[model samples]
Target chain A: MNNAANIAVDIAIILVLIAGISRFRTPAGARFGNAMAALALLFAVAVALYRNPMLSSNATLAAFALAASSLAAWRVSAKINMTRIPSLVAFQNGAGGLAALLVAIVEMSGAGPAPGAVASAAAAVSVSLGAATFSGSMIASLKLSGKIRQTPTVVPGHNIALLFLSAACAAAAALLFAPGDPTSALVSLAFLSLAFGALFSIRIGGADMPVLISFLNAATGMAAAFCGIVIQNRLLIACGAVVASSGFILTMVMCRAMNRSLMNIIVGGKAPARPPASSPATASSPELTAAPPAPVAASQPEQPAADPLSLAADALRAAKKLIVIPGYGMAIAQAQSETVALAGMLEQAGTEVKYAVHPVAGRMPGHMHVLLAEADVDYDKLFEMDDINAEFAETDVALIVGACDVVNPAAKEKEGTPISGMPVLNAGDARSVIVCNFDDKPGYSGVPNPLYERPNAILLFGDAKATLASLIAKLK
Target chain B: MSDLLVMLVVFTASSAIGYVMISKVPQRLHTPLMSMTNAISASTIIAALLLFSSKLDSPHKVLAAAAVALAAFNVIGGFTVTGRMLKMFKKQ
Candidate 1:
């Protein structure tokens, strides 16, 4: 195919991919859109093969690789539970990065003609980025899947180490233009970049995973685009750029949702060092293994004689309007089904129920929606923070399940805190509040929740599943 | 030189268009959209495949084949999982 024809075909395939992404305006359309995207990728692969046919042996190898990987991926994706989607997505992203890494390595060390200065630089960058993304993504997946501590761990001179590694990577990349074969330089560069990625991500954790993952998503896309430049493939370049931009936008959106800057997350992680002194959170529960039976109310002038669960049940049963807020803890407790079951019961009892979803509620952007959808909750009931913030005021009960930070009124009334400027669901405005959290401890941000101390609030602090299970019996 | 310039133009134009279109997608679909884009990023599969169109040693060939496998895995896994997640959404 001539250059113009190749461009035309690439454009056509990209348009098809765009058509697929455009379907994301709704969930039903997104399913079709996902299929369209897959189809477009297949078209690109087929066209490339036709344009440049491989020898027989190479063809056999490619076929085997395709079949084996496709079968493995299909099996895992088809059977995996929805709650684990974030870690799965991270793992897949790392695979893409690994591909880019290998391709860049081959380009750099191939017996083919040496590349020009620009192409060589691009190749070096692609290798480093790809390796970095792979390592960083693996760490993030480990954290998300609970293989590592969810809190940010900062080593001494962590920032300094990151800077030094970045400089070393750049220095090693420059060595790619040296006289001998680029093998040594490539290895050093890839190693430095991998360390850089691991270091960059280790200081980010808890509620910050959304931004970190999204940022890594952008980095991997960028690596692919740079790889395209080295190989002179327009299709790879275009798709890489598209993914890069999409990930970048999501990163920015997540930062804005938390009223934070990207720099703050990557550098100034877990800023407050400790929860505020005014907090009455001394009665904290640390272990999830032991399920506590009673719900401890924070800061009541006189402790109510009745059981907190019964009080919460009474409020829920009498509620004319209810809003349910879900968080990452909900996913940890796997209380999605129980929560949905209770919501259904409330709905059947004539209480209008809605869900208020904070953008940073789950591990990723829109993660809670996926979990709730898996539990058979209607998508229409999910409302974004801005859309449902005001409704909390007029509602009869704000039933919070495994959520914090998002409902903490301290975000509004405090300053100089990690989540000070963050926008929170106004669950505190509701007439009555029932908090079904894992504990009375400060949330992921380590900021004490004043909502737990509200006069009308009832804290059912325990395993969210058991708490909801007992509450589910309230209506029965 | 002109080819490089043209490719740059294509990259910038597509990125701009993707940004605009992706911004239109509601938060409800962010997970599926991101996973779908993850699949699309594996377009390096073309470049990985092209690695074999030229001559190479056995080690290079093995590396190239590994690239092909990883890219294929990314594309297939990302899209399949995204499809499953999207299927779970219901309007009612």
Candidate 2:
């Protein structure tokens, strides 16, 4: 095939792959896919560079190898349950950054003192950025994977140190441009890059892993694309640009979900002040946990579904205040659309409906938010843990949809529990609690919610999506 | 031409399949998926480092050995970390 056709085909393939990969919430298996993509692109580039048509055979072979690996990975992943996938993901991201850095190093060392000033300078920038991302990602991965501490590890004057390193890298770049030895300049830049990466990782806390990972991913891609520009490879340029742009957007979305700024993650400081406890008396209260078992489960139809529905219908028909509490079960059932529809029904009935998002609602952070966003829920209706906590009491009807842990009063009132320190939604504090859960199974933390046993709490047992859709149908 | 086409077809198909496999995965699997990916990544790094360092020829054997060392680090460290993650699910 001709170079132009190959370039076009390669670019198209890479763009599709990037789009497909980005569809993942946390992008599981992205690194494996990325590595394969890199290898394929590398082969194509080497063939073009050597101008050897026969190298096409090698490219085919490499492609086959990548395919085989991906399939094997898929099959193995399907079998054994692996819990450390995030840590592994972090590791692969670090490795990708490392790969980019090494590629830059190889290019710089081999090119020597190229007479083309513009090309050389661009290459140096790519190398420096690549090196920084490589080391920084490694540290971030370690931090996330619990190989290192999640607390602040930044020394005094850490920002000052970063500023100094940036200055040195700039100075080194200038020296290289002034007909100085490229080797020395490259080496100096490498050191600066390493130092910069360390400081950057130290500044970030564990809470911001998702944001940091995405940001570092973008940095790595930019570096690779810059290297591509240096080497004049159109395919590399296209692929790298795609990865970098998507990574940045993902980072932004993750930060926004936490109601945090990207700058806060970078500079790193204290999180929001936690609310002080009221008193031990409130914490030790037994009224919250002593209600009958029928309220907690499908133990009995305590006044039947028709009665609660009539009450909910009355609340839907009469009130202006309605809050929907979504949980992991909602995510598991993929019930965001149904929940949205239910909320829409309530809103149409003149009830102001809002989603009360509990911090650590689902399996990972922002799990419910991501699902809701996928189902086209309005971004404004989703409230954070603190923002929506106070309003729960004023809510005329708290529609607890497929939630267990976050709404559990046990987290707040019961001392010496597993998740006692973890703040949960005050759904029980509302005028009435209507719970839609699957069964009597405890939550991920392996504890039963006393809020489930409340006399005011109505239990509806069924599939989350089906139940919500049914409820929405009834409301309509 | 056939070779290039073969590569493209294979990779696309594999990724599609991987997407399916990844879709059904529970949160319990997140840590394991991460560990496996890390293992593969570390392997790639070692391979690349070895290939580059070997090109230098000076202490080429040492470079190859170092590459193997990195691979070992990835495997052992990867598994250890993975085990710890799995331990979270043991009882609680």
Q: Where is model 1 chain A poorest over a 10-residue stretch in terms of lDDT?
A: A285-294
Off by over 4 Å in 2: A1-6, A15-82, A111-115, A272-476, B1-92
Best by DockQ: 1
Please write out the lDDT profile of model 1 over residues A201-320, one tens digit for every residue.
888888899999899889888998999999888888888999999999999999999999999888897677655642444433433212221243323335555567767887898999
Cα error of candidate 2 at position A160, Å: 1.7
lDDT, candidate 2, residue A304? 43
Once fitted onto the true fold, the runs of candidate 1 whose alpha carbons sit more than 4 angstroms away are A275-305
- Listed models, DockQ each: 0.86, 0.05
Pairs with backbone N, CA or C atoms under 3 Å apart (clashes), candidate 1: none
Report the TM-score of the second chain of model 1 against its true counterpart.
0.96
What TM-score does the A-chain of candidate 1 achieve?
0.94
lDDT of 2 by residue, A225-303 (tens): 5655554544444445554654555566556544467887687543432223324423533343222333533433554
Interface RMSD of each: 0.9, 11.6
